[model samples]
Target: MTQNGFEKTGDDALDAAFAAARAARPQPSAALMAAIRADAAREAAAAPRAARPRPAPARASTRPWAGFWRALGGWPSAGTLAASLVLGIAIGGQQAVPLAGLDILAPASGPLDEAAVADLLPGIDAFLTEG
Candidate 1:
């Protein structure tokens, strides 16, 4: 049966039940309210007063040029840094290097002539026949 809320049994019954339940709750005691207020106040006071400086924000600990020195140490396949240094000085130093300590019979320090290179190829002449 639909009516313009003249049907009291529907809305009226719900309102009355809610009102009855609301009336049954005991009022909070003043002592309990005071304790809750005291807790909130203590919490406010106990919190840290100022923001602490967070470990001075860990600045970059490495120097920018560190990798350049590491690169000079040389990579594995490229050859040892120590060996390369000696070889570079010997090769790059060229005619400037003194050869006094070397054996006297050794070939000269500079590039050889075309005729001299023909001497390196093995031939019957290299057999060292005592004739």
Candidate 2:
């Protein structure tokens, strides 16, 4: 047993094989080493060049409204705002011009009787009942 307490089986052929392996120091061939170095150099050369410093883009407009336009999130946001404004005006001024197809979503014509209300909220009656 060695200092690590590993017990070797007393087989002469196996012991010889292990000793041979320990004595053998395999090394890469010179040609193989050269090829590897060449590949590494080639890869380093082919690597993309450090990004070039880009010139500051030219401003398309210097008008005062340009700053306001940017603050309002550019043209896309302006389009959305215009649409919302138009929709708000249309809905707010419904009496002036009725929106088409809005009548279908209107509430039913008759008054909400007790039976109709009960049908709408079946659990409400139980909730109101005292224990």
Give one digit per residue, the lDDT tens place, for model 2 in 2-116: 4235345588787667666656968889999999999999988887765545676895797989889889999899999999999999998877766786654444686556665
Q: How many pairs in model 1 have backbone atoms within 3 A of each other, for residues 3 or more apart or on separate chains, i.e. clashes?
A: 0
Model 2 quality (TM-score)? 0.33
How would you encode candidate 1's per-residue C-alpha lDDT over 1-131 as one tens digit per residue? 43434233467787677567667878889999999999999988787756533566656449777567666663663467667889989998777655684543355686565455555645635555646
- Candidate 2 error regions (>4 Å): 1-48, 51-55, 96-131
TM-score of each candidate?
0.31, 0.33
lDDT for model 1 comes to 0.65
Query: Among these predicted structures, which one has the highest TM-score?
Result: 2
In model 2, the Cα lDDT at residue 100 comes to 86
Top model number, lDDT: 2
